[model samples]
Every structure is written in C-alpha cells, then in structure tokens.
Target: MPPPNALQLLQSIFGYEQFRGRQADIVSHVANGGDALVLMPTGGGKSLCYQIPALMRDGCAVVVSPLIALMQDQVEGLHQLGIDAAFLNSTQTLDETRDVERRFMSGSLKLLYVAPERLLTPRFMGLMESGPVSLFAIDEAHCVSQWGHDFRPEYIGLSVLHERFPTVPRIALTATADALTRAEIVKRLALENAAEFVSSFDRPNIRYRIVEKDNARKQLLDFIEREHDGDVGIVYCLSRKRVEDTAQFLCDNGITALPYHAGLSSDVRARNQTRFLREDGIVMVATIAFGMGIDKPDVRFVAHIDLPKSLEGYYQETGRAGRDGLPSNAWLAYGLNDVMQLKEMIENGQAPEAQKQVERQKLSAMLGLAETVACRRQTILAYFGETSAPCGNCDNCLSPPKTWDATEAARKALSCVFRTGQRFGAGHIIDVLLGKRTDKVEMHLHDQVSTFGIGKDMPEAAWRSVLRQLLAGGYLQTEPEFGGLQLTDLARPLLRGELSVQLRGLPEKKRERAERGQKRSAASLDIAPADDALWQALRSKRRALADAQAVPAYLIFSDATLKAMLDAKPATLAEMAHISGVGAQKLERYGLEFLDVLHAS
Candidate 1:
C-alpha cells in the first residue's frame, strides 16, 4: 500500500483544493516531523491537522478522541471519503475488533480513530506496539483540564502515548480552550516542543444576539419566526423537561422538531440525530447532551433558552451552526436567574477550590460576553487572547445600544433586597416594585417598603435590565445553594449613594435581524429549498410509510429526504440514494413512488 500525496488527499477527501486559515501550515508542520497543538474553533477543520499528515506519512496515525460516537463518525466519514479508516471501541464486537486489528497489522489501515479508554487497553496497546506508528492525534484535548465542560478521566491517561511511542509526533486539537485549558493540554500531553497554532476564535459567520427571557416561549417563538424562516437549527435548553416541552411546542406550532438528551433511549437519540442530519428545516430542541459529532453543516441558527456553563461550551454549541462557511445566527434567551442558577450550581459543588475558581472565571467571561455592548464576535475573540474589532453584524452593532443611568434603579433594587431579607427571588421582588397587591408581598409586608412603588417610573422590563446588569457586573451575588438574590459588598457603595450605576437596556426581543434593516445572507440559514409541493409529498409519503411500519416518520424517509429531493431535483430511483435520508431499505420502498409523483407534479 502506498500513501497518497497530502494535496490529493485533501482534495479527494475534504473536497477542498486549498486549506482554510492555518490548516495548511499546521498540516505542513506535522508532516515535517513536528508535534503540534491546534486551538481551532469548531468548524475550523481541525480534523485535517493530523488527517493529512496521516495519509502522506508512512505507517498509521491514531486519533485519540473523547467520544466513542465521535470516533465512529470520523471513521465512517473517512470511509465515505474512500479512505481506509477504522475505529476500535466498545461498539465493536470481539470478532470485529480482531478483524480491524488484522487490517492494522497488514498496514491496510491508514487512519485509526479510537476512544482514549479503548486505545489504552492492554490488548489495544499490545496490538499498537506490534505496528509502526507515525503520529498521535488527540481530539477535545481540553478534557485533560478538570475545568472543561466534558471532562473525562481517560483523557489524563493519554499522556502514556508519549511514554509508549516517544518518537511519534502527536497533535492535540480542541475547539475551545482558555489559557488554563491550553496549559493543561500542553502539560498533560507532554507536548513541550509541539508547534502551537491558535487560529482566530471569532466566528464571523454567526451573528450573536441576546434577548431577555420574559415570556421565554413567546420570545423564542418570535425569534424562530423571524430568524428561522424554515431552516435547520438547534435550540439548547438547560433541562431535559425544557427540551421535551420546547420540542413539543415547536411541533405544535407547525415545526418539524425533535428532542435530544441523555434521557432518551440510545436508539431514539441515534434516530433523531440521523433525521436532523438528513432533513432540511429540522429543529432539534436538545439539552447539552445532543450535539458533539453532529456534522450537519447548514444549521441556520443556534438558540439557547438558558445560560451555558462556560464560554467554551457556548462557543462550541453555537459553532455547530455555520460550519459550511455560510452566514448563520447565535441567539440566546436568558435572564438574571439563568446566570445565578448556573453560578449557584458550581459554587455549591465540592470541587477543588482552584478548579472552581477557574470555572467561575470562565463563567464570568461568558457573562461579560452576554452583556457586552460591543460586537459579539469581538467579545468572544478577546476571551481567547485574540484581538478583534467590532464586527458590525451582531444585534448590538446593528442597534448601537444606548446606556442609561441605573444608579437610582440599582439603589432601589438593592434596598428592596435588604428590606425583604434577601429570601425572595426576582419575581416577588418585581411584584413589590409595581406596588402589586399580591398576597405574597402583603404577607411579608413588602408593600410597606419605601423602595416599593419607587420604580413606578421605569418599566418592569427596564428594572429587570438594571438588576441583570447589576448581577452581571458583580454588584450582587446569588446564594449558590439557596439561589436567592443577595446584595454583595460591591452593592453597598451603590446603595449608599456613593456610586452611580450604568446599564445597557435589553434589546427588544421582538425585533429580529430583518426588522432592524440588517439584511441576512440571500441564502438565509442553509435551508430547505422552497418547494412546498415536494415537501408535502415527501411528508405524506413518510407518514403513510411510518403508519404501515408502525414506527416514527423519522424511521422512514427523514425531513432530509424531502429537502434533498427539492435540492437535487432527483428524477429517478437511482438518484434517490444521493439523498442522505433515503437508506437502501427506504429507497427500495419509496424511491420510485417519490420520483413518479415528483415528476408528475
């Protein structure tokens, strides 16, 4: 077996003649006998850091991935590229694993993707020792840091790759990493001499927007109607219940939506994800659990109904959109409570003080991003030690937010907290502000407080903005366990009239990109081509087939099928296979019928 030229491999496998950003340079560095640490954003083509070198170098390259399914998907995708790539993990049966090892021994395998746990096993290690190794690749290398979102114990053991194959150049890659996580990857991987390539973290394709979460579902509906316009997107919720409820709500509102989380059965998760990839205009309402290796490139938007734990997590989740190098959106719906709830959870956890402090700093940076009045892209880039000017595309840039004097409002809110004993949440406190005769306020005599009815001039939403800004700006803290608003030492200065506060008003949630005269790309959100006839036909066919099989419509031809039919204008059964959703069994069952109806209409 002979190795392919790097340029040919890149063109044949990835469908690109030239590399993006630092990809070619990173590839050359690894091919020229150098170890590398690549900090590329999601969709930055980090896979090619070692993939190209693996094809050009002699022997095999092993990619140590954190997720088993991610490993499997990479291998399968490589196979799609007509390359010899295999994975070894718990998914493989004893016989299958042995057969893969046989291929490895024969030098027929150019690339092997393995879960860290499986790769470190005695049997796997012994087999690897018998074969010649060219390079070692680590994916999600941030997991080596305890502070990362998806930390795995097995990642720490990956250092053994250096001890076992000391001569092999290793490349570590991650989509999200701060100074702390970056240091951890270098130290844990023992890549003291690795060439570090930190690409620009700014995702210029994604327009970032944050809206306050009052009547969250309504806000989400308005956002979806304006931005979505029948496109594929992901909605990230904090809870499984929210995931299910939001998915159902979207479906009820005439959306082809589905839910994904750890709560669903593995079979159901795989089926839903498969549908998302194949279908156009499919909306996946999922917890953080769903998206890791989902390769869908045309996601028009990534919306979050709750605050993410960290900026890295937020960036990775939002990066899921616009991977195809097209303009997309990152819409976030959250409030002061979302910020506090997350901070409270971590503050109460029994982790190491240093680790908790580091995570808190990361969360704080994310909070700053949410509250930033400058370009959203600049805020995200600054977090990664990258310099960026205002992108002039985000909600802030389009509207040019104006700040207001929040000193009086801040003082009143702080005074209300002090008078109410700091036991109540934001709602009850808001109730007190409007002089509402709510029983809870009367029961606590909160109506008697001077601060009550003092905020009558400002709208409740404005007061909420002030409170959120105060908390975000570190003037207050929420008890990590109790999660009640509490005045911080910093609040004392404002409350005592010693300091005035300033705040940027919340953006009008009702106003979308189009409403503000900020035109979206002509091809808004890699979307399903407009052909209602084909869509209705494919859907009808799917429903009828699903009824006959007594399975979900997704189990039949996915939403992807109709979109593909509309896109490719498939005229025959042979062309149906070109659509991702119509598998062999499905093609045999419904292919002819689809083409006949498509042609007749």
Candidate 2:
C-alpha cells in the first residue's frame, strides 16, 4: 500500500477535513524536501504545515522550540492522535531522556520536540548524526531576530541546523513578525532560499477595545463581571507585584485566578500553568514573562491593565485569545502614566542607543494604536505592512470615540513644560497649569512663572488628556533621569502654532458600552438556551476524560469540537466519527463516551 497523503493523514489522524489557507501547499513543499518560511497568525493552523509533513516524510522530524511547557503541550496533544511524539527538556529525568533518544534512534518517533539549548548540545547533535533525520522545524522562528520582542539568545544558534544537516529540508514558523523581524529571521536562520508564505495578520474573532484608565482595577473587575464572568482569560500586568495583587484581587472577588511570573518558584509556576491549561474558567494574571508558547484554545479574553512595550508584543499577546476562532476580546485600559513609565524604562535601560531608539519607535506605535480614533484593527494591520478595510469589530469602529480640537490646550501644556524648566513631571506641570498653590508650587515659585495658572478653565483631567496626546503625538518626551516632560524636535511645529492637535476626549459614562458588552458576552458562546445543558454535559465529559489522562481538556477535544458535537448530536460511534474533530484515533478512544452523553441528553 502507498503511504498516506497529506489530506488523508489530516483526516484520519488530525480529524480536520480541509487545510486552511496555504497549509496544504506548505505541507506539500516541506514533505517534498523543500525549505519553507511560514508567517501565519496564531491559531491559524501553522502546526499542520509541518506536522502533516512530518508524518509523510521518511524519518522523525526534529522541532526546535524555546519553551519546555510548549513542547510538553504539543507532544501531549499529538499523543491524543496516537502519533508517536516525545519531547526532551530539563523536566525529564536521565532515563526518560534516554528512552526518548532510543525511540528516535529506532525511527519509532514521528516528531521529536527539543529545546534549542538541548538541540545544540554536542551529545544531541551526535545522536542526530547517528539517526535518519526527516526535517527540521524551527517554531517561533521570530525569536532569532535580535530586534524582535521575544528574542532568545539560544535561537541565534539554530542556524547550525542548516549548516550541519545540509540535506535536511527545514521549515521556520512564527505567528508574529513584521518585515524587519522577518528579514532578520531569514538572515539568522540561513533561510533566504526558503519559500516564504505570509498570511493576513487579522484576527477577526477578537473585538479590540481600549479604554482610558479610570480606576483601572475597578474597570477591569467591572469588565469581567459584566462580559466574561465564568470565562477563561489571561490578564497581563507590567509588574510582578501587580500580577500577584491582581490575581489575589480576582480571587477575592470570586473569580478563579492564578499568578504566574518569574518571581514565582518553578514548581509553583508549573502547577499554576498546568491548572490553567487543564481546568476551565481559570483567569491567569501574569507579566510578559508568563505567556509565550501557551496553546490553550478556549481563552475567551486577553486583558492588559498596563501598556505593553511594543505593538509586536501586543499583537502576539492578544492573538492568544479566541484561538478556536470564537468571538473573544482584547481589552486594554491605557493611561498617560503607562506612557511615562514605559518611556522611562526604555531610556533608563542598559541597551545600546540604537536599540533604545528602536524601542522608542515601537512604543510610539503602540501608543498610536491605543490613542487612535480610527479602526484599531486597521491601524494594527498597517503596522504589520498589511492594508485592511476598517474592521467594524473594534471599539472605535463600533462606538466612535469623541475628539476635540486641542491645539490651544496642547500649546498651553507645552508652554507649562517649558516654563517649568522642562524638569518637572506631568503632575507638577498639571499642578502649575491648574494654578494650584501647593507646597511644591510655593517652593518652586512656579506661581510666579509666566505660564503658571494661565488657564484654570480646563479641568485637571482634561489637562492630563492634552499632555498624554502631546507625548503620544511626539510633541513631548520624558527625561530618563526624573521622567520630567520635555519637548521633542517634533514639538517645534505645534509649539510654533504651525500645527493643530485633535485629542481623544475623555470617555463618557460606560453604561451604554456595558450593555453592549453584555450582548457580546451572549454572542461569544452563541449556544441557544435549549442547547446550553447539552453543551455543559459535553464539556463535563471532556473534562473527565482529560483529568483521567492527565492532559489538558483541549487535548482531549477542543471547545470547537465539542460545539460541533453539540450541533451535530451524533447518535452512534459511527455517527460520532463523522464529527469534525473525531479522527480515527479519537473515535476509537472517545467516540462511544461522547455518543453516550449525546444519547442521554
């Protein structure tokens, strides 16, 4: 009998009937010993491009990954398909590693996931030389780019795969990479000759929402209680202490939450991550250190309490939500303080001037995205070099933000910064602008300055809005030493009355938005009230099976798969096999159990 083709294997093993986008072409090219560099968005089926090829090719395909948790998760999910997949990481004992090595040497393993650090080791290289290797898959290929947000030093050494295994066809894949990062990945990985596939970076399932920070923690709580109360989500904070405090706050407010950050013990981090993956309705509060390679499919939201460092980081993080292509949210509460803190962090860091310049540019782009009154999705896609029509899914598109002509207010704000010797922060500048006679004002004698108290008509909040827009629009910058507001060269035109400014107005009361959010909550799941009971029953079955197998619930079957089952209402094992995710292996393992539930319901 002939070897199974990609489509056959995809159906029989993975249970998907069709390849998405360029997956089929990529798989065919890689299977035929051609190199490929694939840039697909997260949840875009990038895995099948290499995974199906791995099965069709001659020997075990070696996948180089950065995170051990990612390797473990993928390997476990592959095992559910009855594929002989294993990972070698620090978490394994010597004997366990030896066993996996033996399996690889015997050509019994279809895919072997190894960290770049381990894969580059002399011992592992020797083992690879002794075995018949199929292909090389460098996942998260953008990490090789020094300019990328999630740079891994070890990934820089991955070019050795091409140098050493000259004949082995290799594939590099990433979910997020702009043109510069893409070029860097090609250069660093020696993949210049590889066939490149660039997919659209739009995630239509995610509703992008950015709110001005006002009692941010309370706003976050309100968002959760109103729109996502029993949902699994990830909340990102900029500080470890904030992660801990936010997790505790959520728990105190009756949400199931956990904290994950570098400060946590290894065991604690692992346990929390495991819980997050295996259980439902877990809100993981974490810093940027927490979520690089998480593969959970049912995360309904990704909330950021503070601004991310760059637009690339924001895109990658927000892409984590709605992985199953369901309606989800990418919500952020941004404020002027976030801008100051991030600016100070960049300027005060030990990085080279060139790198700091790049960081500044990236931060400015992120701020523009946050402060944009146009379609948020369009702005994001444009940043990645893709033109998109205004997606009516973002908050700005759904409910347009109000803007005001702030040219005069901006000039006043800039004048205050200048009059204060450009050495005062936003607070002192605002104080001086509001004509407040506090001790600092008396001590500095700013009350005597020409610009001090020049305009008490504008509220303090409005002054904050003007200053923030000034900074975001390159009219002002912060000093590295003391975070004092200073004028950038771009401020010249605006300060000289040569340029006008229109700033986003303070958001009105959120009651109407809250009502829309409630509607969105209902739409996110979209199961009819009559089908809700059966949906819960199917989820319970999946949970039970996952707990028994000690793997994530999604590994058993994704929420998408369960929803398919609920819709199809398959009656028998044979009928259950017809469901989208019910591959041959899963049919044999779980078809009858799910069929039983469906029949009972």
Please give each candidate's TM-score.
Answer: 0.85, 0.98
Q: Highest TM-score among the candidates is held by which one?
A: 2
The alpha-carbon lDDT assigned to residue 374 of candidate 2 equals 98
lDDT of 1 by residue, 1-601 (tens): 6556677666544545567899989998888778999999887888878888988888889888766655655675565445788988887788998998888888889898888888889988998899967789888798888768877788999999989988888999889988878888889889888889999887888888887788787778777786677878999999999999999998888888999999999889877876776556899999988787666666878999999988999999999987766778888988877887877887898888988888788888888988887888888888888897788887788777777787888888889888888877787888888788799999988888887887788787877777777788888778776777889899998888998877886565455444434544433634455666666776777667656744445445434446667678788777766675454545666678788778966
For residues 1-601, what per-residue lDDT tens digits would candidate 2 score against the true structure?
Answer: 6557999999889898898899999999999999999999988988889999899988899998888877888999999999999999998999999999999999999999999999999999999999979999999898998899999999999989889999999999999998889999999999989999998899999989998888888889988888888999999999999999999999999999999999999899989998998899999999988878788999999999999999999999999998998888999998889999999999999999999998999999999999999999999999999999999778888778889988888888898899889998999999998899999998999999988897798988888888888899888999989899999998878889998988898877784466465546543778989999999999999999999988899999988899999988987887777788789999999998988899898
Candidate 2 stretches greater than 4 Å from native: 510-519
Q: How many clashing pairs does model 1 include?
A: 3
Candidate that scores best on lDDT: 2
Cα deviation of 201, candidate 2, in Å: 0.7
